[model samples]
Target chain A: MDVQEAEQPVKKAALSKKESKLSTLTRELKKGKHYYILMAPYMIIFTMFTVVPVVVSFFLSFFSFNMLELPKFVGWENYARLFLSDDIFMISLKNTLLFAAITGPVSYIACFIFAWIINELTPKVRAFMTVIFYAPSISGNVFFIWLIIFSGDTYGYLNGFLMQTGFLLEPIQWLRDEQYVLWVVILVQLWLSLGTSFLAFIAGLQTIDRSLIEAGAMDGIKNRWQELWFITLPSMKPQLLFGAVLQITMAFAVADISMALAGFPSVNYAAHTVVTHLIDYGTIRFEMGYASAIATILFILMVSTNLLVQKLIRGVGT
Target chain B: MALFQHRRIIKKRLNRSIPVTIMLFAFLMLFGMFMAIPLVYAINNAFKPLDELFIFPPRFFVRNPTLENFFDLVAVMGDSWVPLSRYFANTIIITVFGTVGHIIFASMAAYPLAKYKFPGSRVIFSIVVLSLMFSPHVTAIPNYIVMSQLGWIDTHASLIIPAMAFPLGLFLMKQFMEQLPDAMLEAAKIDGASEYRIFWTIVMPNVKPAWLTLLILQFPVLWGTNGGDFVYSEELKTLNYALEQITLGGIARAGVGAAVALILMIVPITLFVISQSKVIQTMSTSGMKD
Candidate 1:
């Protein structure tokens, strides 16, 4: 044993010398070949479906292509038109930003807050509350329920309630009116937003070590707030980061709800979002290039916001 | 010294104040009602007699509940050119294939990513992370182009294959797999287990909770899918698309719409109820406490 231990330093010293990058990489590959095999199936399919399409979308953004004709090399003309010339695109952009600003941070914090609060309850109650919170997200097309509530006629629930209470003389057009459409859409979006992230937060809160809280108490962590701020938040960084990504993506992709609730091109485009505009161009007009440009802009915006949030999350307990 | 010890005991017992607990309950109840009303309304509407459904100051509760709407749904669906059973079959085939494929492929990918130290893993993971930020809408046009080029338009492959590599599944699986102890893997390695055997027998069984979570997540997405832009044939269309058509049949079909909505919602919610305990249990222990 002594002789083997004495020889280990000599062996390590010989291997510590500079080696060519190619040789080292080849050696590493040989050592980890099984991992490569395991990853191959998913990587291939993911590349074909996800990576290739993203690259194609980026490439298509620079050209002027209708579905029927060959793509023309317009060289940034589409993007220039999107930003400088198209008025509706600008409106869509502003509406999208406003939606994201309200829903993104608010929904994210709401998920964490509700998860935290729910964690303090009995196990049975916790499970029940989780289902209640998560139901809106999973129930397919149930946002249509909101449409019924916000219907323009007096028979609509919201209007009916208001009339009965003597709040308004006439039934208001809640969804059709420009003033209320965005707010209605936002409210529904927030309702649906407490989804996967909320589940993750619940799981995350559950995962915190009970012993750590005891340790904190022993260290004079005085109150529940302090215990939460120091012990709970820092430990669940992975779940927090996961929840943030889900919420951010959900916030930016607000087209479906707006389309479903407010009607497409919502009463003078008050509820028009970047994604809806992309859909209009891509599907309705078949202007693939211009649509690609809109998609690229959204992609960049989401990525940048994600990066910024990630940076901020890194300092959670510092 | 005795007083100090007594104060410590009080502090430990009062992890939360009674008022705070009451306030939290109140807040949860308020939001809970906000969340519950729409769903409860849908369920209540499903059973309401047609007259009750259309009444002004629309009743929140059904005065006379009946299953006539469900029967009416069956009658309307019966009149369609294609059989309702065919649509149900189509939906089941797509959902099962899509969800099972996703769980398998995602876990396969996530295992290597979380457990192995290899070249390009970091780059690949970052790509996965980046993909999570962009909505699928961004890729829809290009994906359609790719689909047509591959002659996958109108084929079930268009739906199933794309869902197989969903980034969220991979992300969740990887995060869960990271919590596994490396020493356990090493012990398996020492026992002459092949990597495949290790992953299949050891790793897969350990991550059962994540499997359920992925199922709960992926099933609903596939279940609600209307076959998107690719599918065109009536026979190949899903139940959701069929339901959408029935719902759009307008005021004449409102009762049926509510019934179909209830039908669409029941399966996923049931799945959640069954799997939620495991999901919550899994997630509660998922935080990396370091």
Candidate 2:
């Protein structure tokens, strides 16, 4: 009885503290209603389109939805089937990881290196070089031109050249052949991967303060290597991090190029990726639950890789 | 004196090595060729006579160039139910509205998050950054569901409205807006200006470069959109979607396909050329320092 009596006041005090905090929050909301108003249009739409959909997809992953019937709850079944029994899922996963492994780092480093080199030229030449480097990325569906270049017939550019040079006896079916499909997709992906990050790097290099470089020189920094390592890299951490995230996301989402170059469900599924697999299930099969499961796995893979890369980027020049 | 002379030689060599310059130039030329060949091939194919296009030992450059492909494109497009001009108009409308709407909404949201110390600003900004890592494909199925529910599936609103709040533009705008001085806002506040007034007069004008950067970045994405999975009506289709269909018409449409490809490629490339100078200019001043 004494303990109960003693706890009542403490509980009352805690309740009062909560009330005060709630009141302060209300006061803040009332004072800053304009900020909410300013952000309301975008926030409302963004929450509806992006945030809610992501949550819905996450929830849908645990069901047996076919979009025709009511979604039936089937906890862990979709995921189990994905991992244990689905052979194509395994293939898609392997292809996606391989694609990301090749294209992600290669394109990232290429973007920075080319941007760095181009930064050395005079402004007019730099502009020209930027266009040349950036043209392929902006050219819509221009990768389809590679189709003619790698055409299987003797008329094909690569085939004709190889045959004329006596490197091969017959023209090889590059896109149709399982051995060559993945490589060709990776090559084209790399070509197109220089879009945003390249521009960001160019901008980043251009923005480096000239005084800082001169100061570094006076402080005993010798050669361009030291300048790039200690000064330029450290200064452009934001752009680097930004570029890394974009590259990582793009690397994981390799559907469009793969689908375009190597026909969907390519021979032996050589060019099949997680995204293409998801598209097959989601759009073609209408297996919402399984597709969501695939999407969830991809989301986890991408976010985890991005987090790891972000950690590595933070340690740059330390 | 001899040691000093040796050091001078080394420094001069370090500053501008002839061999290194030659190596970099060589690399640039090789990479540039690799990047430019497909585009050059497409441009050349657009002008080639049909006979040349089908020739064995496929040539990189056209010996005989002509405008028959363009005329053929017009002819093929004329046979379609919807005129090619409608597709062009639809594309222009979508891209213009999408880009302009994205700029306005993104800047509006970005300004408050960047400048004001509101209670949820940090949380909102963090969400924006986190969303940057999410591929749109992951959300495509659910987004389709949401769009159907909103009755936006076949409408241009499906493309334009959702794109207006794209996290990338907001992220870029917020980052760019952070460079604006706070004192300017304070001065406007002291002069009896509303927040909207300040955002419109002071903030908008000051961030012209960021606006151009946003335009350049967003324009190509929307311009190249192939009606996505939303729009279905023939009249509502974009030029890119029409171009894809024509290309898929097989060997008969190859010449016209090349012509359509050139048309699609040229618009964005021209926009990039016109805006890239300003983008570079703005970005030069807006360096992201640690």
Candidate 3:
């Protein structure tokens, strides 16, 4: 009886503690109920469209599902096949990495440099230049104009120009030839790449105070490069980071340009990318499980690379 | 004497050297030309007569321009089973609903996220930032399943609903809203104003530039969406898809295709030009806070 009495108070104590924590959470939620209400519409749709799909993709990566039968558990077989057996995937991974490696950094620097130069212009010229630089990106689906330029015949612009100049005796199939497809794709991608990040950089440049440059001059900064490194870069670190995120994502996701210009499944899969591979398996082959695994890998690659870049960007001005 | 001597500082020409300035201008002109040429060609191609289009040593500028391609485009669009207006209606429906809903919802959400110090706010914002790092292609298959489950596969909801939650608009809105002073909100609260009233009457009107900025960004995206995968019904397809079909009519239709491409390109560019200053103003405050 005495032992039961002692244990009863202990049980009550634990129960009361848990209840208090629960009550505190409820109290906090009640206090912020209006905020919750305000955020509900966007948060609900966002979860349904964005967040839930990512979680489902991760889960489905472990199962073999074709939307016909039950999703059968496959463990690591899909991933194993992707790594060891799928030669096309390896090619795609290589192509995607190469594409991202070249376009990502080049476009990022180009965006900043162009914005910086354009910023130095008079306001009238700056706006004109902004529109000129930004026109390619905003002009939707006009990338096919590149097709007319690179069209594999003498009637095509490049071929016509080359033949007219006697630079080449014959027209080259720019989009068809394996040797030129990736580079052609890269060129178009870069042309379209000075997009959101460029605008952001221009805006970032505007936000930098004028006094900082004058102060830097008095502090014995030698040149424009020194001023940029010590003063301008540190001041716009936020925009730099923002631009990095936009560029990195656009860089890694290079399927649309490849598909539009080089043709889907380009000669020998020369322009094949991770996203195109995902599209192939998911839409064409209907191999949902394998495609999900590919997506999971891509998701990991993008997120990890962004985290690394963010870490590196933190050291920019220091 | 050196310390007391006044240093002349020209604000406009802060750190310019003549040779460097000349070199910069030359570089700018070269790169700018590379960027401008294709756009120029597309516009010139649209105005070219069919004969001029096919001429050997294809010209960049039209020597003799005509509206024949535009007339041909109308004729071709007239011949389709679905009228051109149906596609126009669909595109309008998608873009208007998507852009409006995105602006309203993102602003509403950003208010609490920017102003309130509540539980789960940090976590929610972090998720949004993380979502921006990856493209939607990764979620395509799963999203297809989701759309089918919701019976939104053949409907405009598939396009409109997903677009409303596009993380970029929300991110920008949040950043811009953070710059709004807390004292303003506090003053409203002292006047016994409710959160909803304070938000609707006070916060929104003050952020007009941000709204315009979101419009400029979101308009082009929704305008150009072809509704490729989620939509299947012929009637439900967008203007972009229809135009794309016209362009696919091969070499004989090149002039008409250029006309279509020109029409497609002009709307968004025009919108950007009209709103350029406002967009830049909003973007000035769109800096991430670590």
Candidate 4:
């Protein structure tokens, strides 16, 4: 008690900027030490699963790694080969870009249209409509979609339905034939995107500034068409950006559909994604180094696209 | 003056109406069919035996209905790639713990990041947000290498731990946590509660809806483990793996495969029904927007 009384007067005299920061930091730490302990386990797991894997993959990219043989440092050879030698790699990259370009916007537009229509409906109807779309996303019932689309035999659901409705003369080998397989993959992805994207768009619409619509109305804008073009769309820019980025990444990175609809070696690799390619070579072929190289390229491409999208979004905003 | 006013009213009402209503209706019907047709087939056929499932023109409604498929689920499911029970158990384990662990850890990390801003806070938070931009599929190779290094292949750690820090959950949780009043936490702190104690006792009760939201949102993904190289071990397989194992059996077992899909949809659909409100709210909060 005696020591504390003497120390307060000395400490209370004044503090330099550095001392003030030191004291503030000390106080913050003392107040929040328990939060750090709580966060430690999660941080550890995040680092192990996410951060460490990223680092290991980066290093592995430099090595010519086969699972059986120890990784040997090859130093840019994998990247050089990916650029100079690999034709399939380039095909995969092109396929992914085209897929993203097509599906990304179509699905996003679908989301907006769906949300707009649902917003026009009454709440109960909107909820029911939401359930109709979102249930599939929730169930993720991939197996059933597989069943509907790819029934290889004459009696397969899609083939049978198309024939019965007279859309085709014969059953199509949707997965087996390479020429038609990419479309099949795209169709499945479109369906999945519809559910998630529509749901997200609905949420976004709900968050919009209702007053902005009113303001637009006061400016003599009274029609739905005028409202959408001038007020609604601009207000939804962030959500739109989020959906676009998400859809593109998911589109480029899609492997599950290819895996489900057409298994490995995926019908002459027609539906092969960069992801599936990495998994196939790194995992199945056990070529870790080459897989890492492919993956690094993918990482670079995705990050670059994100940067460009952000720039574009910024432009749109301003 | 009356004539001019009447003309203004007509012009206002006319105001260049759009004619896409018919097209919108057509899109609605097409999409509704696209979404509902699969589930209808799964359920309608689930109740039908082998003979009806194979019938030509495959009638929309089942001609014969039976509990035979449900009973056969246990029997035929066992005979597939891995035993159905093992894979189902695996799926259950991954879904339950992976989701629960995610909510807990993400909540903990989310609280400080959302409510408290320390030095390096924005930087750390941005990194988490950045992780969300990169799909997990892109990281599969890297994660595989890391998992192997830890000798964690063919174990629950591979499936469960990585899922715990998933960026979407963290982002959503952080956003939601920020919406909560800081006074609630402050009151608990003043009452002399520990941080963990405050989270579990004070914060968790408030966040029940979010946890429930995450549970329903995450179950399908967690349970859909496949029998790939990264997850082929007996202890590591999920219900999806079990389903794959069955379909991989020659043509005779196709019936069993359809049955498993029917079963897989049950839990997720059930979860969706129970947490319908919370799921909707979470979607409203987190779904894409400006």
Model 4: CA > 4 A from native? A1-31, A141-144, A165-167, A195-197, B1-23, B57-60, B77-83, B287-290
DockQ sort, best first = 3, 1, 2, 4
How good is the docking of model 4, as DockQ? 0.37
Clashing pairs in 1: A203-B283, A203-B284, A206-B284, A207-B284
Worst 10 residues of 4 chain A by lDDT: A140-149
> Which of the numbered candidates is closest to the native, going by highest lDDT?
3
Compute each candidate's TM-score over C-alphas.
Answer: 0.93, 0.94, 0.95, 0.88
Could you give candidate 1's per-residue lDDT for residues A1-318 as a string of tens digits?
999999999887767654456689999999889888888888888998889988999999999999898999999899999999999999999999999999999999999999988887667777788899999899988888898899899888999999999998898998889999999999999999998889889888887887898888878887778888888988889788878888998999999899988899899999999999999999899999999999899899998998888778876776
TM-score of 4: 0.88
TM-score, chain A only, candidate 3, equals 0.94
Which residue pairs collide in model 2, if any?
A: none
Better of 2 and 4 by TM-score: 2
DockQ of 3: 0.50
Which runs of model 1 end up more than 4 angstroms from their true locations?
A1-20, A218-222, B1-11, B284-290
Report how far off residue A148 is in candidate 4 (Å).
Answer: 4.6
Worst 10 residues of 1 chain B by lDDT: B1-10
lDDT of 3 by residue, A13-44 (tens): 99999999899889989999999999999999
Indicate the docking level reached by candidate 3.
Answer: medium
Candidate 2 off by > 4 Å? A1-20, B1-14, B281-290
Interface RMSD of 4: 5.9
